[model samples]
Target: MTNRSRPRILLIGTGDTKADELLFMQRCIGEAGGVIVMMDISVLGDPPYKAAHDKHAVAAAADKTIEAVIASGDENSSMTLMALGASRLTRRLCDDGEIDGMITIGGTMGTDLALDVALGLPLGFPKLIVSTIAFSHLIPPERIAADLMMILWAGGLYGLNGTCKAVLSQACGAIVGASRSAIRPRPQRPIVALTSLGKSCLSYMVELKPQLEARGYEVVVFHTTGMGGRAMESIAAQGGFAAVLDLSLQEVANQLMGSVVNSGADRLMNAGRHGIPQIVAPGAIDMVDFPAWLPVPAELADRPFHAHNRLLASATSGPEDRRRIARAIAAKLAEATAPIAFVLPTGGIQQWDQEGEPLHDPEGLRAFVAEMRAAIRAPVELHVINDHINERGFVEKVLAIFDRWVADAVVPAGKVAVERI
Candidate 1:
């Protein structure tokens, strides 16, 4: 696109500190079929290699002079200023169609700056960071762009060694390869956004995806992990999807119960805000997530627990929590400017909520039902089906409501379908 044989890869780093490492990365990228562009984020010292844009240019980009930033001499504030500057500069390069991909290497301060810069770019753009804390839980999901890749800066810090060079060479090759093989956006289609937990909880997504595709609509299922729900809401808010099947309401219960897997404050409200035709359900509202690494919260640790795996454990929602979550969901639905079909599965919400399961909680389900029926208002069609969420009957009920929307012209009839990703 830039009329170049090799894609241009932007090398970003704090030149004052890791100049040698940054310079090494630059050379490695060049050897790996990538044209190198550099943006030096140094605050106190010179870069080992001359950057296309240096520390002075960076400070000026943030509307602050290099002299002023240096005068402050505060590591924290200076790093923040440099990151803002880098983000601004990176955005400009993207707008100008100059950068094809980007790679940044850093420890604490460097990693922090990389996050700001990488998040500034749009999705599908190749952004990679080689960081010391690549696998750490300290990273915030909200800040990191969905497609950003990170390599553990394994031995590639301080100075060059055989080990560090090996790691750097691998990172360089990865960024170049990624740039050469850039991802193209999915073709235009009527995107049906669906949310769910894994196959352990719901199988309706698997059943409905093909059925919807057969009817000529692309089904995009968003896993209802905390970040997954937020990402779905992000895309939906931007009008990326034509319709939304918000089948998993676990994030609502997670939010109400103060679980680690809560989406955010504005989870269920985005589709309503953007007037997207959405089918809502009380899927997986029976449980709340607790991190397996830590002990469950003292208040409800005694509740019915199901260890989903090593990393995640779930506890059954109580009647009070379910009622609160139902009210929250209802309130969000009430504000919908578009048609909403809210489906309730009477038999069970998830696999674990079935007969004789560890997560069985009829009292909590009853509370949710009582509150939902009372609180939800018009423009939202409520359907009560006497079957489990994974059952064929429940799947048909959802499809029927969506089909009705199509017939009523709420969802356009001549929609195109996309192959499942």
Candidate 2:
């Protein structure tokens, strides 16, 4: 096989039982003009061929010796050690620009090892797994990364055959294809991260994205879906964003109130802790989300409700819940050392929050505002705008804050231009 200047894909799996199949996949990748970096993670046996990262090095990376890893002699302990070791080593390889993508094929233990290492990589760094558990319903969100991909192992089990080879070849082609195409040459613009509930709530994001792009800022929008918020925060904590437009905070409410679509605990704190300037709003704070398949919790069914679709539903929060949400928002903002603007859209926060809508609870809104006023102090400037969040009036107010921050050099001015879309 000849090497091309294409992506070097990392193949990680057990060498004890699956070495033949792993080596077969390696040949397929090589024949496809891709480079392969093979890792042997088996505790009990050796690979058929030389491995780039072997069991000994894998164990050592985890602060354990291969002998100790083997001494444990259980599948759980062995897989755990190998996964920990592989994660550390793989991340370092990525940092040093050694591997462009990673893939693994295995059954149970192998799947766990592959996932742990691959998930440790950053977003857009193509990672794939051909596993028997790919179709399992018990996947925990924490085990999966934002962009990881998986396919059923199908006919591939103990050895390589026509059926398994076809599957393995497809996986090879996928990683190679991803390596060639997934990562873009990042634009030389400042990055701004924003959160919103799509069109389900009329959001400024539709207008703001292009405006920010026109100003030479690359805008990244994260839906306030539970995982969406967590993904945004994960990247933000890694210093990925120059500034944050955290306009939709319903995830905070969802989290506090036990909704299924809430970002995890560390949602709103990252950009602040990273010293990035932010414009914060309690957008869509009037509701909590639940999957459409599930009945509204008996406790929550009494609130005003909107069936957004068969997939999403929103339930209005009462005065007490609104007050609790406001306090939660305030507590999170209080942790920020960076400059922040807390803007409240006084007229309404969401589409269903306007006049004649199901969730238009002015009394609850007032209670929320009162709690916010009682909780937030200076250094976090507060502003109240009289228009609904979806209105141009609210958009302009947010842009005005952006412009002011640019003028004060709190954020990069970029090539300033804002055009209506």
Candidate 3:
């Protein structure tokens, strides 16, 4: 392929310090059938060779001069400024369809800018970061782009080495391949955003997915772990969904109760903020998840617990905690500008919360339901069902509201007509 037709990868790094490494990556990318569009984020000296977008151009993008950026007080502040400039320029490049994908090489400072750049890019645009701290806890879930790729910069802290070359080559090749192959989340049909855990915990998606598909809507299910909810909220913030079925709120509980295993504070508020039609439930809201490798907190020592896996575990919260969560959920739904519904399954929320299960607690469930009943007010319709959330009745309740909304033209109708086969 010609250079213009090849996948053009935006390779970002401090060219002054990483010229050798960046040049090697550019060569590798060329061999892998991709073209490199180099962006120099260095605030210090210049690269030996010229870059397409130099540090001066990066600073200019932020409406500041390179001198002003260098004069910024500390390294963190300077890098942050450069990150802002680079991110703005990169966004413009993507918007203008000048670049197909991006890859950045960095230690802590470069990685920090890399995270910002990744978050700034549109989802599914083939962003990758070769960082010394890939997968490190130093990076928070909210800062991560839903589709960003990362690889550990093995033996790459200093100059180039054999191990570093291997990592860099693979990262370059991966970004090139991804740019050529990534399937973006296009609205092929009227999209329905659904949130739930695995079928074992919240089985609504199992029935809901096929049922929604049959209605000629495309169903997108999000696992409500920390990152999953973040992805959903990110998409919702972009006004990506025709209707949102946000049935899982364990991440909300996790955030409220001081567990790191949570989405950001704005978990249940994105769709509402964007005025997207939403149907919400308290799926898995009674469970507070934490790292299974850690000891159970002293406060939750006596609560019923379920070991989800070696990496994740959850404990059923007390009545008071459930009441707090109910209030929070109510407050979030109250802000919806478009149509919204909250379904309260009085019997139970998740499978494990049923009788004879590990997390069964009727008292806690009652407290949550009672609090929800009190907290939910008009304009935000509350449908209290006697069946568990996983039951067919609960699904019917949701579908009834959805069908009405579609009929009333509140939610967009499915793009495809139902085949009468």
Candidate 4:
């Protein structure tokens, strides 16, 4: 049996003295069997003190050195630092454990540079920073990604002082331990992609989870935000999902008139190319979400706005918007080779679209149903039922459709025969 290879770490340091520090750090790193593949030093602004102290001799030494040197200066220079560091980090992560963890020791500017590198990595990757401003909340959260640990440093220089040694030791251990720990790689399960906005399809998820699990399918829910829809489509492109249950498609309305959750022009077309089984419903086709106080664009300012919460409001779509949305949805569905089913609820598409609700728009609903029926060319099975979006009857209908699909997918073996002997 072949032994597994140890992880390689890229140790990045700033200024000239880091070369000396690297020797010491390497000793500790070697104890854990870490292979330091690359050592890079930053030369920003002033030259190293050793060269300055040596005067004329320093200039000749700098020219003779063959080590890779990255220069840093103004804003653009700082950006270059981030870009180079991020490139190295990305290569290491991809080659190693896909970035199990990353640690950086720096000051304010260093923190800024390191944080930018962290942000370029994926969301769940571990990030650690040793900085003077560790306690400041002003640091942007986006810079840290998800798993971040920050340490405060009293002095800038690396010394043999008790505190400095202890801190360095801990940081090394933390990075190694985190990298060694079990990482939950993205699952390979047959993903069932479902779309929902917080408002309409919360109950749908609650009801759908058990039904999906009972049939041995993994449910992946995507909120109908701009990024959420894009992420689901990206995952589908990466062959993540076995099927898609697009329950709430408010993003279609948004895409039509340039609203917030507008998933680009491709939208559902990507899933079609992959030939994944898809079932779609116009769950929240009646509205477009936006911030409460932002002036609605001149074209849509007149549309009815309902305050869903203190900060969020949605503009109720008119008949025309719904028709446009339905057409777009149908166009995407037309491209699918896999089985496609669409369900329509006669009572309401969402709680706000029901009778007596502030956003009730019957004309919009009617136009949506009419346009979908007219545009779909792929023999879409449409079931119009008189039930609310979240009613028990509606959930049963959705589950039954999925169950039928699962049953049809099975190939049964059978034959009893008495052969002559």
Candidate 5:
């Protein structure tokens, strides 16, 4: 940790055009007990005041000069060079422990660069982007960093206004506050990355979390929703987990079905890429989620639907969809370099898929089970547990596999804490 008292915030923007807004945010950060480190990315014109790192410095960081950037001859190409430079410099700052957090402001162009910069930093570092299209669908899921924060830059396109000031002030305060309070991940025990939905749907986390922790593993359960799964995959890509219990496949189903509630294309492959031993399950793979507020799509209109709430709803997939997802899951697991185990619970996958629930489809469940049986083969061991996913027996099956792996030295053994008598 640095000896400095106040958090240092790196503020990046096109100073030539957003001088007033940048200066306003600088003052706001100051009042919130933060020091602003300014980096100007303007190519054509300069801001009224000098920035700590100007366009020439940014261009040089990319191994190019300001003249070379302007010589690129197009806005997109010029900005691409600047984006490269800004991301490299921001990462250098973070690696050197010079900046505590980062906040960038802009419309589309600045937001584009901000995404690259944010993605370059490690997880748990505070990175905020105040943009005109903060949550717009125009931004792809893969471009988003796991811990990035964003606020809509309302009414601040051309110049500052009362509404814009309100938004900017709140954003500045948030960045400063986050920088001060952010806790970097420092697990005491080895981390086990677990993925599941709510307790109402996938209940294994309820039992598995405490049991795993008692056995001296830190269980970090990701919700397997679109963003949650993406965050887990992000951390896993960095080799963050000792092992992965990917017990939910809803995001994969969402991706195959072309739903907006889907994680990126690389959903189920990250942990395996790092050779992390993982236990995989098809929990909730029979259903695809869409926003509840919207009308059901025509193709799935005839399928059994369940409204979890006003915000989210799910429709059961047909037998064919289940078969297709099974093959897809198997293909991803096939690429794993480490030991992989696939557990299939024959009775039911989710709470709502049991006998009398709204989403009850015994035939659909059977289809998934049969296809999974045929698809999972070779290096990936398959365990067919004939119990509902929420059943005690199913939990035992998972722990049994985990324990065997630990004993065989495939997984690191959990350490129970001992107290001095």
Candidate 6:
């Protein structure tokens, strides 16, 4: 292990502990050659130290300089203490070696403090929490994304026995082993953005996955939820995407009609501003999604509502409403300098919008498409395909349009060389 890089470990212990207990843990860590960069004992209500003589040897603890940064004498002050400690540890990890893993042991407050520090790290970093409250369901799953291990102390910190020592030692060894192993890097692929609803657009994604991959593109699908739409737009603004296949434009209607998945006013504008090529489709544009009838609000209660599921209540868009949505979409589309194409699936936009379905309204659909075509000043091609939005034929048409646009935008090799020095 002398030639190999050691994984940096952060051990956080809370509450007053016997000196012997601290010495035992330190000896085990030192024997493993794991560099203990930061040890936070702020929960013990004791002053931070430089180095202390344990039973095995002298172990270096966190310096007392951190106390000045955590001068706020409140229970919530633990958060600040943990942040400072984690920052120091991460810095040390970045210095000579990579952070293979991080481990912390504490009570309820300590768990909260340690989890916050873990969340600040990137997605792939390893984190382990040994907590008295580890078994509790109160823990938020979002706080633990990467490879996180949680060990529940059955009888709390005071009940530590031989079993506890073995558990902690095993955890240390596991983290060290993980650090030495090589993680295969994913191939960098051009990102292709797609908007989808689990119900309506699942089939489209299944059919288009191979097609996009064949062209060396990584398709990133965004559920047309309220926050999901905003996330996709943010990525587009960051220039993280090669092209956008906006299959589900229902969130625009949701915004106007006060549905749950409303993407605000600036849904599709970011891609346009970034000058990214886009292929837009009116999937699920025929309806607006909401919760139950009780939460539908008094203003929209009189509208014709249908229960899509037990939780989802939707209303079919009328001709007037469709026209408004179309004009709004066209207005946003007109701002794009990049090549844009709007494909209209004439047969149906969603599962319920097909023939003999409850929400099928071709008159309203036609009016919407007509208004959109009239309003857009840009080259918004309207393809009246006979298949539904999720159909294989519809996916093929979208891929063709995307291929044509991509080809036209490519700079010739000879022209590229002439422009360069």
lDDT tens per residue, model 4, 344-367: 877678877767777777877888
In candidate 1, what are the lDDT values of residues 84-104, reduced to their tens digit?
Answer: 999999989987999899999
Q: Give per-model TM-scores.
A: 0.84, 0.85, 0.94, 0.60, 0.94, 0.56
Which residue pairs come into collision in candidate 6?
Answer: none
Q: Tens-digit lDDT track for model 3 on 1-421?
A: 1133489999999989999999999999999889889999999899988899999999999889999998988899899999999999999999898999999999999999999898888877889999999988788777888788999999998899999999999999998898877776666789889999878999989889998988889998999989899899888877888999999998999999988888888899889899899999999999999889999988789999999999999999999999999999999888878888999999999999999999999999999999999999889999999999999999999999999999999998887775597
Cα distance off (Å), candidate 5, residue 420: 2.1
**Candidate 1 TM-score to native:** 0.84
Clashing pairs in 2: none
lDDT of 2 by residue, 1-421 (tens): 1113578998998877887788888888888778999988888888778899998989999999988987776879878988999999999888888888889888877888887887788877888999988956345444666677898888876687788877888999888888867754365778899998887685688889888887788898988877777778877766787899999998889878887676667669989999999999998888888888899977788888998889988888889989988988988998997999999887788888877988888898888888887888888989888888899998898889998998899997775455679
Show where candidate 4 strays beyond 4 Å: 1-182, 186-189, 199-202, 410-421
lDDT of 4: 0.62
Candidate 1 residue-wise lDDT at 173 = 93
Q: Distance from true position, residue 16, model 3, in Å?
A: 1.8
Q: Between 3 and 6, whose lDDT is larger?
A: 3
Q: At residue 243, what lDDT does model 1 achieve?
A: 87
Model 2 regions lying over 4 Å from their true place:
1-6, 68-81, 105-116, 131-143, 152-169, 416-421
Model 6 stretches astray by more than 4 angstroms: 1-186, 199-202, 293-295, 302-304, 382-387, 409-421
lDDT of 5 by residue, 121-235 (tens): 8888999999999999888777788899999999977998999999999999999999998887777789999999888899999899998998889898999879989888888
